[model samples]
Target: MNLVTQLPVSGAAPKLLDFPAPTVSGLPTPALRGKPVPPAQRVYFYSPDEWEVFITEWASGLSYRQIKQLGGSGDRGVDVAAFKTDNGLEGAWDCFQAKHYNRSLNFSDAFPEMLKILHGVVAGFYCRPDRYVFVAPQGCGSTLDRLLSRPKELQKKFLEDLNKSSAATRHYPKQTLNSIREYAQSIDFSIFQSLQLSEMIETHRKTPYFAARFGTALPERTVVKETPVTPSPDEAVYVKKLLDVYNEQDPACCSDVDSLSVHTTYGKQFQRQRESFYSAEALRLYARDSVPDGTYELLQKDVYTGVIDTAEANHPSGLDRLRAVLTQSGQLDLSAHTLISVSTLEDRQGICHQLANADKLTWVDTNE
Candidate 1:
């Protein structure tokens, strides 16, 4: 029941579509928000590559450093793959297929992906993903969207379309066709779904790093959805080591892991990690929103830039300097800018030195 089999006939893979180069400006507004001119309308402006990156990061709740793009020749139809761990088993994968078609996406756009996924499943190219998403800027056409909503209708339609006598399947060798027919009967149609660029933009608007990505104002805490992440085995071990080190440094400082977690530096890092976990958890609530790819890195760069500008200008401290710059530019709410974690003045100052050493003090102004 979990398997999906509405597949295309096998053939040499089609060339990748020619997507327009991505840019931050000049994004088209989507029809859905035409008159009202909704916030985040620029989402419709993203290149397919940009959309794919955003989808991977936002949906997976992975930090910018963790996501990997796999779109290209030999990608096997999957544009992005996000690695996740849950329940200690690890490897909970989600696959995103990006279709950057200029026109509204129709069955033809989806069929080859279906074929690739079905054939991949049979051949074990990858494990059955927890979610298999079809991402596009224009979104799905009426028929496909309707079918996606009603699984049985989708199953019936797919089978009928790929019937033995249908031209779509006529070219498949008999053995392949027979195999596909058998597979189609048992494939699960529910895994197939679509997301529109506009919806994704709306979702991204509420993320913590949204302002950094689009140069829009940050959402208030009330609207800032949190994303939570599962502690991988490695991360868990690292946390344990941090706590253990704290205990060794000052036995009087902590009696157990819980107590050690309260130490200044370690505690702050732990809290940040906990925030990340919650942010990941929040991602599920905004399944359609994806932080545009590289948003986090951009935020990091901006924060660093703010820090340096403040230091050079003789601002009170790195923390105060960064906050003043971001707040003045209207990109941050000084009362609650949780985009980066710095528990103390020392931590803030240390970050400035680190960024300075790396020679990466260039910050983008909200105006820019």
Candidate 2:
């Protein structure tokens, strides 16, 4: 379909199976098997297990046996169904409407009236659609996000469903506890009762979309203590990149025009710029330079800390590399809170982008 959000959906549900409107002399000519609909839009193409996860959540919330009532056309436009939660209350929620696509769908077909057709969904469920959430997987368009961002009633409905789903299972991030935090930060989802969400994410990572999307998505972060200096694994990568950059920019070979020959060679530039990144004085104290506790204080205390450190603990310059990012240029706009959410927490309910920063080095945990 060209533009799904605006397609021609005037009929309660398009006769998906029937092809070119059949015309009989008297009665409707038996609808010819229409041009085949695309596989992506066809219902049977979806995974049954994943559908069940959504179905159970949706049905259990409203105490419905099944959504079969709306089988082919009843869901109104529900692509994924699930129970929703708010505070601690639960409700059957229809969500992940195809109307709200996960990332944009690339279509070879001409959908001149996709949006207009899709709006019929709004009309279908007009009298209390229960809940409406559009999944914009590749991330919502800025304009669309802005439009949806402050949708108070819509927001409330979304949150209510999420919370309800969470509460029924005791408020958890069945997908990934850490993701809850990320979502809260990225999309500003509420975390008023995040603890409950955390437990759920940990225990329920088996749910279809939950497992697929949030499954094992956390980053690996570790600290290396050599020369008694503390740096994180990512730091090593940053420092390596920085050193390469610095080596290129060092003032070694000069242009004959100015004849400042010192700014041309990598070796000479390395020698000149090396001091800033790896000072003789700092190296001399490396064995004795212990990280101040204030830094790690930020990482560990996030509501979503990890169970184990990480796989990259062996690198000596990891943490230092991250530190360099924070204290240097080309790297700007950082704060402890932002740094705290750097990595993808194994837990999934928290945002760990703090570690995602090049400046995220390991500092001694003050609270330790």
Candidate 3:
């Protein structure tokens, strides 16, 4: 058997939680982390608006009629639908029925509910890693254990149980035991990266990365824990440096960037349709936008609130102050029309800092 192709044994996955993650952990701390959406479950629990937000973020369609078609009801089940469309392997969405209550999660009642959500997710295409997910703040009793212990047969049984009850459950010809196994393989494990507890416990689970990291050193016949090697000092140093450079370049979040262009931010408008930066009326929204061939990605909020309020209120001191900031932080680049904002011409230190940060920016999102 090809060792690399074989299923990984337990002990090989990245165990960041078990490793006493360094205080200087390059990754963002948990405090900066946002709340996770619920795992799989049936029944709508989120407000109509919250669900709308989730759908809009992940899926493009979110009209009231579309919501009804997507089967969003806030009666008592999951709150948000991250991806509910039934398109293809990539589009096969993981529907979540958020069960957000003031009390702790009841996993015992929720695990079975996850099985139900999976069936509701049925379509011809199989999304890699798994098409279904359960979203709950806290789940029913032993829900995690039950989910962890679920056997192939049980998942099939769960599917049958769901198909029998849901009239809305579209008929999937391959709703058999084999299809469940195939679907199981397609299950996306990306969900674990979000759930703290799921990530913690996954330390003990078997996966490909675990194998690649530790290689084939198995336990003695008598039995004992497998010892995984930690990164050597040299390896750790290289990894740290590489990560530092990588972080500054990746634009998904904070990149030490130079130039970027996005829709402009027109100031608040009385006309319903005139508020967007993309609109022609919003061209005067900023002095920078008036420059030739200028594209604005970020609009300092103070620019709008301060400038507009000053001009409308007929305040000279305000205009002078606003004009001063522009001379310094013009958001200038050679490709960009020379516009100046806050810094003084002699502010060598400020210019250096801006230039250093700008070197990393690529108008095209490098992070993505």
Candidate 4:
């Protein structure tokens, strides 16, 4: 059965730990195992506030200029709003109404929220949103889903329900409710829709917040294959440092990149070092998109901590010190870091250059 069909519609929602352990089918070969719970199933356990926050995070990934969460009291029916311009609701915008409940959302649970928007528009709280979306963990009930699929029927149902005397919408002023009927009648109900739980989860997967929120593994990092033949402006500091290292070994060995490129031995070393630098650069770029901020910086800190003593100790030559520090960096136990899985050997070695680029490490003793 599908994951949603396995959920309970009443009582307390099931926790992640409550699910049965994966089963291994009996076989001589490796056994087949059950799949982990999908994000769609896990979302049912989030509190109402958390649901709105998730909607906010998801909305931020869309092409909106800004996303704001207005979920608490006096929010005027908007939970999370995505704006296309700085003018906010005055400009084109989309409203995501977060509905968290023990069961799927039905017409009764959604109509009041719908009225709030209509009322808000007529009351000058804000203009009608370009689109209105219902975000619920358990999705919509069969009746609500059917109405949403048919725009004209959904609009007709809203008008019919607006005329009925019900406590659900009683707080709306009589005059306001009467005025909203005309505005509601004109609303293109096609703009009112439900966000599918699976769609939200899939789209959220592309965002940096996904792995942290859903406890999912990050997407695999692509390898950086090419390093520039000529050094770029950003590589100036480290390249100069390498030149200093080569010159320290033998004063006339190399003066600059053009001179170093033809060196019989150090030329090969320079090429390898450049490749490693670019590999680490690739990791930095990948981490910026896949994980939270400072993750790559933390990795750099760990690498520096691993090699600082080796970098400080006396060496036979600057080349020896550079080699020893790089060796120590590769041996570091960085299993605690999030990027460790995708980090390559070149990336570890290249981070030493990144440190040098920041003037954190120096090969030759300047005091000498």
Candidate 5:
């Protein structure tokens, strides 16, 4: 009997099978399914040290001449220091104090750090930073936020707390604490501020390290430059090699780029090759701004490795060798490369030409 026919029929309607709904226990949540974590909440997930590192990277992208992470023991309350001049803290500088707490920072959480900075300056540890920015994932609590906006009130509260508690002065003598208080009173408290998580993430987005840090997509590749009407000095090496290949095929076919430009057979071929070369050049420039150092070079190395054996093999002429090696390059399995998604067939062919320009791959075997 067919399965459908074997089912028992109800008096008024066909009976339905009572199969339990399939249980999906291990399915990914929205975040795993490509939903991005908001930067505000995501910063809280970083460890204290990692948060310091993130701030350092973000500061490096700014106009600061130097950035240093001083987060461990004996750091004297500075987490990340951004120097505006080569002289470092001896000159103008800004301080970023990273606090990676589960909750927002309050006046109590910030007061001690402020005292530490004041003490550092008075103790000759370093000059007072031009700006003291508190960097926390949850930002400042309402109470602390209000105090920051009113610099005088914040200073008054800081002094009151300094006298009431020894949190920042336990190891120091009364004279030292007095010195810190006097130093604090002398400087402008307006320098105290807080960096919002959104502001930090926005600035960090301009840096090459953002994608790696946040698991975000890289910026789109820019358009490739149009091939020039005439060969440029930069194209001299590859252009010379292409002329040699054409000459090998037929000595009278072309002697130089000027003659080759008007050749009936090779002129169009030369233009297409230049387009491919520029395509790869565009990729190189994109990789510079989008990926880590040496990423584009690695792609070029991969192309050279895939085609070198074919290039070395015997061929009827230099033109034949060039065609064979380019074919081999096109067939390379570059899916593993970081740039594979943005790469193109033209780029692969152009990279072979780039290798030729570098003297790494010569179509015409001079010794032979």
Candidate 6:
């Protein structure tokens, strides 16, 4: 009997089905997906504000959730700050000042920002940061880079530049240029550093939101198909072998082969096996679906190479072996569109045996 669930036309929630809908494993459905951002256009088109967002996201990896972006009016001197707390006492504090420039940043370009840091510290607007970074699309030029590497040389340059500037003399707490020089002399110019565009991009890639940044899908894995309700006699035999491998005792084996998953230990092992199976299956399926018929085997060999390289390291436990297999899965370069063409879990288990007999894999019993 077909049961149709009805809903309200407007201003009220619709009646949900008595039974929940089926869901796909390992797939996430976000409300908004990343848009396609071409590499060439990415850096060129992003504004200063967009750059701050990028920096904030990258910095979060280092300081985690402690990194904060100060965007509104009264930010004192800091643009972004990363604070660390240890033993209930304030630990390390770092600040990043983002400068978006089309051309390379020179000494003159950095001077103003340096003055703000000095003024903020002296005036007690904020405590001095352990590390102060100048972030820019085009990093400091050769002259500034050399000056930064030498503390004495940088300090000399700062004073020399400040003395010649009417802006420094006119502004500040009514102090002579010499007073400013005395204050600057006491400061540790070595705390200053620069982070360029390339470094930020590299850090960003390691983050979970990496695909979202580039508007690309995450690395694809094999799609799971719905198994038939009735299991063949051969299916039952393979299921028992799998149950034994997972060390499941008193498994209520049935025509529904997936029922073994109810046992706690078996469930965890099944997930790990499923993940490895999907990865290996993606490679095999990719080979079959290639433009030219015979190319699949070549691709399969490449996948085998990746798997062997990742999994060959001596692992003491089943958990370690499982991790190695999962790592290899992430390394596979299958597309989301093509990865759906995978074999059933039973078929993949057969392939694992094929690999074992070929000496490609040695499925040793290990404590998980």
Per-model TM-score, in order, reads 0.50, 0.22, 0.30, 0.84, 0.84, 0.50
- Evaluate residue 46 in candidate 3 and report its C-alpha lDDT on the 0 to 100 scale: 53
Predictions in order: lDDT: 0.52, 0.31, 0.30, 0.79, 0.78, 0.55
lDDT of 6: 0.55
lDDT of 3: 0.30
Shift of residue 41 alpha carbon in model 6, Å: 4.8
lDDT of 3 by residue, 95-157 (tens): 334445534455344445454333333322222223234433333335444443465543544
Q: Between 2 and 4, whose lDDT is larger? A: 4
lDDT of 5 at 308: 93
- How much does candidate 5 score in TM-score? 0.84
lDDT tens string, model 5, 166-229? 6555766787777667766766789999989888989988876575566566688888878999
TM accuracy, model 3: 0.30
Ordered list by lDDT, greatest first: 4, 5, 6, 1, 2, 3
Q: Which ten residues in a row have the lowest lDDT in candidate 4?
A: 13-22
Worst 10 residues of 3 by lDDT: 13-22
TM-score of 1: 0.50
Clashes of each: 12, 74, 50, 0, 0, 1
Predict model 4's lDDT versus the native: 0.79
User: Candidate 1, residues 1-368: lDDT per residue as tens digits?
Assistant: 33333443244432333232223321222224335434445556777666675675455344322344663587766776655654211246666788876777787677767766656554445555666788877788998888888877887877776664654565456666566556767768888888766666666555533544555433432343442334445345334433443444466865555665667655565455345433433332322243333433344454564544444575433334444543443332222332333223332333332343344432322122
In model 3, where do residues sit more than 4 Å from their true spots?
1-71, 74-92, 102-108, 111-131, 153-301, 304-368
Error of 2 at 337 (Å): 44
User: How many clashes does the backbone of model 6 have?
Assistant: 1
Error of 2 at 278 (Å): 62
Candidate 4 lDDT tens digits, 1-368: 22122222222211111111112221112222587666787788998877877887676567988777663377777877788999887779998888999889999998988987776776666777888999898899999999999999999999999999897568876766777786777668998899898889888788766765665677888869799899999999888889888988656868778889789888999999999999999999997777655778888988999999999999988889999999999898887777777778889999999999999988876568
